[model samples]
Target: MSASVTKMVPAAVILFGAMGLGGCATKSYVREQIAPVSQRVDALEAKLNETDGTAKSALSQAQAASGQAQNNGQRLDQLNARVDGIEQRMAESQKKKPRN
Candidate 1:
């Protein structure tokens, strides 16, 4: 009975030892598991940088367009004033003419 009990204890120890090792992850295995997630995070960071640059460029373009629109509005106002002066001069000339 003692001999059988000793053999069973050794067998139990080996089985439990193997199971414990199986449950623990190795470094390479852990790295493999995390590789895809790390790649996705890196890709997202790159996209964020790209979007930031594009947004800055778009903002500058919008500012330039707004400035051009303001300049055009000023020119239009000046042109209207010149047209008014011309009409006023023509009216004065007509009034000065002899009655027809």
Candidate 2:
């Protein structure tokens, strides 16, 4: 039992030493691994901002077009009413003329 215990103590020390030496990462090494991912995140954020700007512009244009269409519709209604009044006066003037 004593011989086995003495042999295990050295084996345990070597295993623990190897694990401790291999487990830690240097700051430079960590930065090298993370740099590409950071750049990708920044690029995606820029693209998202650009898309958001475009969407806002499109929304404003659509609102302006809607207002213009409504104005055109109101103008058409006024023109239609004037045309009806003119047609009624023309019919009355024709009826007053002699049948010839």
* Highest lDDT scorer: 2
- Range of the 10 consecutive residues with the lowest summed lDDT in candidate 1: 1-10
**Every model's TM-score:** 0.70, 0.84
In candidate 1 the C-alpha lDDT for residue 66 amounts to 100
Model 2, span 1-100: residue lDDT tens: 6999999999999999999999999999999999999999999999999999999999999999999999999999999999999999999999999997
Cα lDDT tens digits, model 1, 17-60, are: 99998899999999999999999999999999999999999999
In candidate 2, the residue pairs with backbone N, CA or C atoms under 3 Å apart (3 or more residues apart, or in different chains) clash, namely: none
Residue 97's C-alpha lDDT in candidate 2? 98
